[model samples]
Target: MQSPAEDSTTHAPTRDCDVLVIGGGPAGSTASTFLARRGWRVAMLEKDAHPRFHIGESLLPMNLPILERMGALDKVAAIGVRKSGADFPADGGGYNVFRFERALDARCDHAFQVRRSDFDRVLFEHAAGEGVDARQQLRVVSVEPLACGGSLVSAIGPDGPCSWRARYVVDASGRDAFLGGKRRIKRRNTRHQSAALFSHFEGVERREGVDAGNVSIYRHAHGWIWMIPLPDGVTSVGAVCYPDYMKTRRGDSEGFLMRTLRTVPEVAQRMAAATRCADVHATGNYAYECTEMAGKGWVLVGDAYCFVDPMFSSGVFLGMHGAEQAAGMVDAALREPAREAALQQALRRHIDAGTDEFKWFIYRFTSPAMRHLFANPRNVLQVEDAVVAMLAGDVFDNPRVRRRLRVFRALYAVTSLAMLPRALRNGLRRRRQSRVDFSGETLQAEES
Candidate 1:
């Protein structure tokens, strides 16, 4: 038997399993681990091998409890830099740090930042430890749901073709959203959109002492930039630019990214001595959602269901948390087939509620009112604490948080009214920018 810390390359041409999870990222691994621990025969397929390069290295404070629950906290802590808060450039000056401890939930006071290659492998390996049949470098080609039950999945592994007959399917394929794209249920989010260019750098300046590990956010006229401190003195830096600005790129990805970084004085200053250690990567169609989260014998988790702007670093938390909830619902549905529809509905409602909470803020994040409020926060009726809680991904299960968020929204509306002229001007620019289309095909292909 292979150790959980070791990847298994054992193969089978045909196999039957209770659950087939697509993608070995956070969501798929988390779901497979939970189902396997519940005694279900589970098989997880990953398109790429572990320790692969990926973006989204920053973790939210709420992710800590989930990691502990999955028994991978220590493994992650060993490789990740302890991140206590996030900072964004202020309207008039330096930066404002929103420490996790300031959030309403005291338990979620810190998180970690690591290279996604290492972080994802820890979770995937943990799932394998929990009895999941985890295999990598297997690209799922098709999933055909049977009328009776389950699905017939076809994939190409490292050696040759393979197939599986699964009683249920979970598509946690991150941004690929395999089922969503194949089934034609995925739709671009028109209200909010962006394209991202990111790379890792060595020698980028970090904050001092306790704040050294904090993620710094800088807002520019075109969009925003993120400077995330990772271990080994490598920092993950990226710029999320609106399509209109992105369409203005005249040169190579690296040159364009460097130019964009230079536009933000705060980021340019910090990177004055930094050296790019990795090739630049870019992705377009930054926001999208599937029309349906679950249907019949299949369910979608993480970016497969929906993806918004990552301004708040909510992607991983949302994906992993949804997977945890999905495992329970799927387990119940397997035993009571008649309640499948009801269970799926409940799951959709729960996931949508959490996503929408972040969406409200995300859609308005780049506006004049939001910029001013975040720059000058207040605790009137504990609204600032509520915003802090939301930043920490504590939107679910906290009645006080939910109640205070409503107050914060009301305050935001008042602020928008006060800054109506600037709000109207920025909104027009955003709308125009959102209309530009950027396939990002060349950018992604060059990476290969």
Candidate 2:
């Protein structure tokens, strides 16, 4: 059996495992758990302890099946607030509500929004229960690929520095992008430069009945905001805006967030009587993609590989889904070394497929034509169902869904043509806005 050296005074002994996974977020936990179930000796190093706070609290219908496969669906369901649909409210006083039940796929009609701390802990603990050598409070500092095959990973935990030798490595470090950063492959997405300021609140108003748990998206002059309802009556509220807007911030994060929140009448009205229940948080330059996703001894998954806008709450779903895909590829690579190239290609295809499916909508989220389409969704050509299916994260593995998406894209194109002037104007404005760099500036303005 592979084990660490016992002599603490000497150089730290190198341990061994079939695979070493970095980060314990959804991607790390999912991949490690699945690999362990496959009988691989896996060790997962997580920088944070379980039940820790995390930002992505929303889940898509597609995530449910993966949870079921991991045998954690019941636990997730118990902690999650049932989310049946989503609501998008435009500044013009019009709105559109898309229900999951209306999606092209009939099996996945509902999802949930839970406290990420609770959700992640459930998955992490499940990984441990499945016999993964899961270690918390351990941060992977460096990973070096061995010439003979595999990698040597160095980490610092509560105890001190430690090292491990593994046949393969999986980087699921979320935004940390440990391996990607080391390889200098993480590239900022120039097309979608954005930032977010958010927090949780109690007493946020909810719609009656089935729509109570529906996540609400509100568009304002600055950008868009999301208000997601959680099971304990605590709602997650956040705004995704241009980097310039975030760079104009002033005061504390909470005050700046509140000032910005008050600008959106729809969101403001809902939060009028709400009480802040958590510290406000801000994140800038929220979109990026790694140029290389996989190589000989390592692979990047989830936010470690790419992070798009969170408009559709695709973060958790994409992370977990990528994990699912990586798990299979890792298994294949272990069994057949010669198939590494094929496995890498498959992984890339899976990642690209999901990102490409959502990126168009994300990039055009602020455009007038896209807004019009969303505000007035129609069933013509089964486009609405297709859009709903996309929101449900059903873009992959369904030929029918892909065909419907093509129709929806065609319709969007026609709509853009009909409003060419406005579309052109919005497109130009977005291009200019995307060029803004908020990285080096300290925002001082009280409001945007």
Query: What C-alpha lDDT, on a 0 to 100 scale, does residue 212 get in candidate 1?
Result: 97
State each candidate's clash count: 0, 0
The true-versus-predicted C-alpha distance at residue 186 of model 2, in Å, is 0.4
RMSD per model, one decimal: 5.2, 3.7
Clashing pairs in 1: none
Model 2 per-residue lDDT tens digits across residues 332-414: 99999899989999889978987888998998887787888888888987889989999999988888888988888898888
Q: What is the lDDT of candidate 1?
A: 0.89
**lDDT score, residue 430, model 1?**
60
Top model number, TM-score? 2
Identify the runs in model 2 with alpha carbons over 4 angstroms from their true place. Answer: 6-10, 90-94, 423-448
TM-scores of the models, in the given order? 0.92, 0.93
